[model samples]
Target: MRATTIHAPFDMRVEEVPEPVVQFPTDAVVRVLRSCICGSDLWAYRGEAARQPGQRIGHEFLGVVEETGSDVTTVQRGDLVVAPFMWSDGVCDYCRDGLTTSCEHGGFWGTVGSDGGQGEAVRVPFADGTLVQLPREAASDDRLLSALLTLSDVLGTGHHAALGAGVRPGATVAVVGDGAVGLCAVLAAKRLGAERIIALGRHQVRTDIARRFGATDVVAARGDEAVAAVRELTRGQGAHAVVEAVGTEQSMRTAIGVTRDGGAVGFVGVPHGSGTGVDLGVMFDRNIALRGGVAPVRSYIPELLPDVLDGTIDPSPVFDMTVDLNGVPDGYKAMDERVALKVLVTNG
Candidate 1:
């Protein structure tokens, strides 16, 4: 079998590696059919996030059950499924409370000695709690499969951001960043009935997707200029809610600046570079609330799945580029160079 490995910055290879097997009674082996590179993967590719040489990398995947351990009963051979970025034991208190990411036994893929989602197959721990079944027929529908793939991460994550930001019917919402997650945040806000959505981004291609996803306004500026544009658009009142989808200190500040005095900000950007340390003084004086961290996507998937199946939301557009296992190195290059919005990795 062949899987993606990182040897250094901008170097990913699809080389022969050991195939996974059912290692625990709660485990299952999935024959991967679809997987994609996440924006966060770039942290490793850019050398910003420390990763051991030859560490397996990738976190979102959809596949069919090839085998399952004795304790795994919710799925069987031939069933199509999607795995969240993290695997968690379903019976934990946090899992019951919709915080699966914090489950007592939860763990992320691509860690030391773990198989990643970007390969021919994966060893899924806590299969029942981490894998969500999708219709078997979807395997043949390329576009639908692509849309369903987002359920494994981005769509659920975007929904998490909107929920944290307190999006409600008729509320004015602003999203910072125009990457795939940010654009999906705009879509989530629309699904929640936000009347006005302001998307901040400088990329025409991504901002264009933001419009299609439900952004009513696009601010193509940064710093004070971007803040002023959003404020002016809201008549100096700012947005009722702001979502920080970029995990930069400046982006967080902009999210706060674009929010109404009494509003809230939901941030989902992976924090790097001391990006999201909020100012207590500003939050206290403005009566603003801040909430958001790594999204527990497994908790949100059940609610968002039906919508994707029913065509209520089509997030497939976020995947502007597609590559096979052999092209993964180029895929990382495309994303790093901003030549692709998001790269979808497909297998048969």
Candidate 2:
């Protein structure tokens, strides 16, 4: 088997690697069909996240089940599945509370305790709890791939942001970032009945997708200018709901500052330590609500999968760059340079 490995910043390689095999009673082996690159993956690729040499990359995948552990009766061989980015034990306390992302036994994929989806095949732990079995009818459906794949992360996280932000019918919502997750937030806000969806992106392609998904306004400004634009659009009152999809101090501040007093802000960005210095006093004075962290993808997959299967949403456009497993380096570069919104890597 061959997989994408990051040796250092700007030094990524696709190399031959050992195939994964089921190692635990609760494990399942999946032959990855479509795996895509994530923005978070760039942290390691740039040496900002300190990834070990030869570490497998990617956390989002939709694939076929090749094998399952002895105790895995919920899913069987040949079934198409979507594995949540966060592996969890379904019965854990936090999982029961719909916070599977923080499950007592939760483990993130593609890192120290796990392997990512950037290879021919990968082993998923807690198969029954972590892998969501798609209906057979949806297995061969071409349109389901993008939306189904999103259940592993972006879509679910977007939904979490929307829900946490308390997006409502006729509400004005602003989203920071035009990445897959941000576009999905726009889509989520639309689904939640938000009347005005404001998306911030300088790229025409991304802005177009955000519009197609549901954004009613697009702000091409960055930093303070973007925040000011959001406020102006809302009659200087700011948006009723704001979602921070980019994990940066600028984006986070924009999200908070552009939201109306007493409104809510949902942040799903993989905070790289920049979220710690927020002005809690301002948040308190304005009566603003701040919520959101790692997306509890496992808990939301079931609800969102049906919408994907039925064509209620189309997230596939996010995959603007599709390449073979061997093109991993380009995939990483395309995203880091903002040349691609999302890169889809195929194993076959």
Name every residue pair that clashes in candidate 2: none
lDDT of each: 0.92, 0.86
Give residue 313's lDDT in candidate 1 (0 to 100). Answer: 95
Q: Which candidate number has the best TM-score?
A: 1
Task: Specify the poorest-scoring 10-residue window by lDDT in model 2.
Answer: 270-279
Candidate 2: segments with Cα more than 4 A from true spot: 273-277
Clashing pairs in 1: none
Tens-place lDDT digits, model 2, residues 31-88: 9888889888888887888887777778888889999989887788899999988788
Against the true structure, candidate 2 reaches a TM-score of 0.96
Q: Each prediction's TM-score against the native?
A: 0.99, 0.96
**Clashes (N, CA, C under 3 Å) per candidate:** 0, 0
Evaluated against the true structure, the overall lDDT of model 1 is: 0.92
Deviation in angstroms for 255 in model 1? 0.3
